[model samples]
Target: MSKPVIDIAIGLLLHHGKVLVGWREAKQHQGNKYEFPGGKVESGESPEDACRREIYEEVGIGIKQWYAFDRIQHEYEDIIVYLHLFYAYVPDDLLTLIQQPWTWYHRDQLMQLNFPKANDTILQRLFWSHFIKIGDKLSEFQPHADSLFYWRVDAEQFQRDVLHTYSADDLTKLILNDEHYQQLSDDLKPLIKTLHLKQHQLMQFKKGDLELGKRYIAACHDLVALQHAEQIGCEAVFVSPIQPTQTHPHTKALGWTQLEEWSKQSQVLVFALGGLHPNDLAQAQLHGAYGIAGIRNF
Candidate 1:
């Protein structure tokens, strides 16, 4: 007999650099394990609505806004589950009012807790830092344990120098632009785990054309492209021109409202790019960005 399939909406309530999680009751299916607060998605109910309802029902906190973080499918002995994850930020004042059984754990501390097997993927992803640095010269910036580096240099120079300096493990925190990625040899490809697709590249992209193990992230300027990125298997999208930039001073900025709107509309993580600086990370997060990416301020 086939296992029953279920859809679940999981919320990672983030506040003050921590996530709100609850202990699973001993009578529950996955008893004694810690789980993010959420429940099953009822028939005819959208995952977003399911998440909002479940969060409120389980935690008694109502959230008007949340960003799509990720989706995962896992199978247990008797059932299959499709987990839809969302991220919501709760204010400091509201954090104090949360009831018992819901505990705040620092992002790093989550790894130490015993969670259901299905949560392993999200736990690894949650450990990624919220800042991405984009630039042409890799040597200009010092390496950071938590941050990701996107080296925007030409394909020839990248292939010639990158492998000699960084290992496959090191490349996990690095991102290569699509142009450079396509030019790399098959053997050299595994060294790159993340690809950053430009607007033009994303427009012409076809699924399965890229390597299977790599994570694709796209640069988008509008809602259409952001949706397209999600449709084409992009795990993250960088919505750009959120602020005025020296490189394109005359280009109109999308601003924070548009950023939040697009973030809510897409299923992938959203990064606010273009003219954003390190100091703008908090503001970007408030506007629904998973992080901030920049060429100069990173």
Candidate 2:
């Protein structure tokens, strides 16, 4: 005999920059864990319908807009769970009507909470999505303070000079090239925030090989590459040559207008690359970029 498989639907309610989550009662399964508010799907209930019903029961609010986000299957000691996750948006007025004790958590703050093991995949997705939204707020982003520094230096330089420049807190996320990543010691690997992969490298990489806390960003020149990056589970995409640069002065640039158009169609967060400067942050946001990425100017 096989253990019963329970189908569950959950809602990730977003408002402003925070997400609403509720604490499970100590008596319930996965007790005391912080989770997106939801419940089991009744027989014949559609996942979307179940999500809406559960959200209303748990939070006392009806979701106005929602779409499927991700799905997960996990087997515990006694039961199997098929979790359906959805991203939802609710009106501000409904927030106060929630019956359960709930809290709004910022993306960074969520890292501290202890959620059920099965929720790890969704948690990572949420964190990346939140960070991408934050990247869009260019006026509030401080490169030295908030932005991850992309280090493209040689391994020898990294160990000698670059490593000593800042503490772990000052540079939490460091992006490294594939060669540099391979050269890193096991101890240094954990310190990296993301892996910067070229188009070919990204195509060759496997999603399962990705580390839990680290993110992957790939350089994409066109829509096909962007779609490929998203399919490969890349956290972000860099749409490059937005402006002609000294490195490739002859290459055509995708001006702000086209950049905006492309970004609107992109599935993943799009970063404007090529000939970008620190001052271009605002302009990048206007053109629908998550942020600006550059080799020399940044």
Which candidate number has the best TM-score?
1
> Which pairs clash in model 1?
none
Q: Estimate each model's TM-score.
A: 0.62, 0.57
Q: Mind sharing the TM-score for model 1?
A: 0.62
Candidate 1 deviates by what RMSD? 7.5
Please give the range of 10 consecutive residues that has the lowest summed lDDT in model 1. Answer: 206-215
Q: List ranges where model 1 is wrong by over 4 Å.
A: 1-112, 115-127, 185-187, 206-210
Task: Score residue 222 of candidate 1 by CA lDDT.
Answer: 87
Local accuracy by lDDT, each model: 0.80, 0.71
lDDT of 2 by residue, 146-221 (tens): 4555655554554523444546544344556666677766766655566777888777766455554456788888
